[model samples]
Target: MLWEALGAARDLGRVHDIAAVLIRYGFGDLVQRLGMARALERAGKVLHLRGQDDIARLEPAARVRRALEELGPTFVKLGQILATRADLFPPDWIAEFGKLQDAAPAVPFEAIRAQLAEDLGDLPENIFAELDTTPLAAASLAQVHRARLADGTPVALKVRRPGIRPVIEADLRLLARLAEIVEAEAPDLRRYRPREVVRQFAHSLRRELDFSAEGRNAERIAASFADQPEIVVPRIHWQWSGERLNVQDFIEGVPGRAVAALPEGFDRRLLARRGARAVLKMVLEDGFFHADPHQGNVFYLPDNRLAFIDFGMVGRLPEARRYEVAELLHGLVDRDGGLVTQVLLGWSDAAEADSESLRADIDRFVDEYHGVPLKQLDFGAMLGDVVGILREHGLALPPDLALMIKAFITLEGLGRQLDPDFDIAGEAAPYLREVILAHHAPDAIAKRGWRGLVSVADLLAGLPHDLARLLRIARRGSLKLEVDVPPLKAFGDQLDRAASRLTMGIVTAALIVGSSIALTVNRSDSVSLIGLLGFVGAMLGGLWVLVSVWRGGR
Candidate 1:
């Protein structure tokens, strides 16, 4: 019991920290809804952590954004990830979460020395000609420092903070547990499937934790763009980089955010087109893309090129998704509402809904884009409305597809920021056409058909053994089905007690009658064994009845 209490207190302590931040940011109602308030009660009563509920004054979505920010890095990463799921959240929530940043206090250089030495294989001075003791940028997962190679090649060294993994792992476990409880206790919250969301978040976060994988992503993307001089991928220093750190060629150029700061000869229109083209090739041609290419992750070279940084989080367009995306785009561009509805139904995880209604809603949506030239159409707005409709209908896109759409929106939004008339659809059309047509080629179709045939053949070959095993289990009387019946044991116990009482009462009454008969038949005898045994059995039966009654009462 003491150990149980200690465990409760520990959970409560962790939960109180989360609850206090949430309540302070105006999410107290949410906390109450999730039943976290009960857990926080003891903590809250001891100290008044509940201030004014921020939700009362600010918009709920805005308060949620602030709450996630104040909750720290994991939540911040969650909010950013949630920002990508336009199919699940409302527009205001997405906008607010998009504002979530990984900005964290810098780990002093001296504090990170051990990690640097371990990853770099020696002291920083020995490994580099010069290493800036100060960080160029500091984020939650890692910090970047400017450094120079022995041959004077400028590079950026990203060092992971010591002991960050355990903190993140603990938070993930807490989140998983909370998600389970919320799903179990709150029926209304089940639709959001908090458990599944946490699962997805865990997968993404784990990938982000590995710097070595991120380095490989960089190399793959760079190789994809090797022939395109206009596109730049900073070369990764594989020998010196590891899970603890990432070293890459340091890029010197104007930040993508500073569009107005481009030199006199720089062309904004050309830059926007080139940037869009580069991203399209990464998506449609290469099936890989920089998922979060906001202006902050981009750089504008003096030679009018676009340099992409930060490959930590990227999206892969599988051949299937790529094909479907092209169809989706084509459907929207041509006002083919039937095709649009088909694509949406394919991605829906919920029970099949009214197809006709879906078609009507999509037809109405597609009609809005009619007569607008493809070049003039706002893909971002169109996508937002489509996703909003999906959210309304309880449909969810796969994570990769959602991330792909968000990337497109970000790219288009960035392009328009640079030049109001820039059209991402126009820039992406040729590339999309090439890929879609290639997939439909006779050879591609034949290859896909043959793969399907092989899979079906394998399944058929395995069916016999599977059936034989099931038959063997059934014949041996070993086939058992376990079910989840919460009150089955209590019901069975009641039935057992009643049966035992009935049987005991019957036996007692029979023994009393039989003993009377034996006594009647053995009259005048010195001793009667039958009468004596009958009397003894009666007494035993009576005792059994009394004991059962007492046990039952107790």
Candidate 2:
């Protein structure tokens, strides 16, 4: 009945379209292995599925990227998320997925005029001094236009596409169903955790679709860095923001990617250091960070202040995880391979492997770089190497933890692009040091100890009740213990058969001895019944033992 329900769901949702798309990209085997081939057959018969003619000509990574792009926004977002998972995917695959584009044609302004006016509480003319119909940027989810307030304050107005939510919501449903099917049907994919990845993607998409959520994120991050004059986060105007639309202060600065086009006299070195410091602080201290800090999402103001945009995807860590990560980085600094190994394993419940071997691998990674001075070490290259090792060892990080790795990698890349002598390690060292000190501080230790003692006391308080319940069950003769013993069952049976044979041999020996003694003593008593009976018993026992051995061997 459960399978039937799943089958019906497969037919009802977009699984058919999804399967057809996979088949077109030469991923028909994946579809079959996921137990969706029957649905694919039905879809194929209806749609007359045709594989891409030149699919075989492309590399596997390129094929995957192309398939995702053709599948639409949800899959593209999945690809984008996968691109951040450097510790799971190969470098080539990550590179290919990084190219997943969400660009879409702009929606007509007339179509969204009502939504915009509604979100803003009035028409554009009534609420703003001026508004531009032409979009400053367009994407599958939303588009932004340049606007100005009645008080002459410049702002960026983001408008959601007229009917995109339903489409995205439908795709999300199909993806959730498909993820469940994939996890259940394919054991090899279990380690990759397709279900968990999809869950994270769904959560992220929910946050992304609501412009107000993004506004809130911007506000929180802005507050985190409020004291730092070197960094800028756009001010969100909540009065005009809603689930579908957002309004924020317009930033007038050069995009970080176009460093060559910047006017002369700009201090690239200063910009690079400030950028690295800002991001490092966010990860190691603030515990909240913009996960995507690629060159495009950054802007450079005239005073060398760096601005971050796009709060759609963010990463957060609690204090505990933050401390662990900081210690991991510090381990890298001190060349403490064991500490690094411990921290990495603590980050996720990865498959068990040889801890010594993993530690050795970390030692090798650190030894190759830690000896070099901080400023001279290639931090980006070292990080890439670590990611490769992690993938090889099946130590893929959880989604939120992986985001910090990606963020740091992005910051290093940006730094290197702006200044060849950029020092990521140097910039991150002080923050990590502070975290490490706090981690071992006396007050922190005492607090942790108190928490542990409270947990132990709670357990003690419940011990008597648990013991009474167990004793009551045993007394009532209703105690049942469930155990896994398939491996032991055969061994137990063999031991039982051996013990029976040994007992039979002992009985036979005793009978023989008694029979001999009786025969000797009754030699003159002609035809003694006791001796005859003893001999018969011995013979019978011997035969039984022989038969048992033969049967057991067979």
lDDT to native, each model? 0.83, 0.83
Error of 2 at 457 (Å): 1.6
Candidate 1: lDDT of 6?
27
Candidate 1 error regions (>4 Å): 1-13, 26-49, 53-55, 186-191, 481-554
State the lDDT of candidate 1 residue by residue for 305-396, as single tens digits.
88999998988888888888888887888889999999888876556567788889999999987799977999999998998888888777
Kindly list the per-residue Cα lDDT of model 2 for residues 1-554, writing each as its tens digit.
Answer: 12243445433446666777888988876766554555544444443345777997899999999989888777888889999898889999999998987788898899889988888787788988889999998987889999999899999988888877766776777677777666655556667777888899999998999999999999999998889877999998888888999899998999977977878767999999999988887888888899899877899998888999989889998889989988888788788888988987776576575677788899888888755888897766766787788788877678997788888888998998889999998998899989889889999999999999999999999999999999999999999988855437657878998999999999999989988888887676554677788889999999999987974563
Model 2 clash count equals 0
Model 1, clash count? 2
RMSD of 2: 15.0
Q: Output the lDDT of residue 210, model 2.
A: 92
TM-score of 2: 0.82
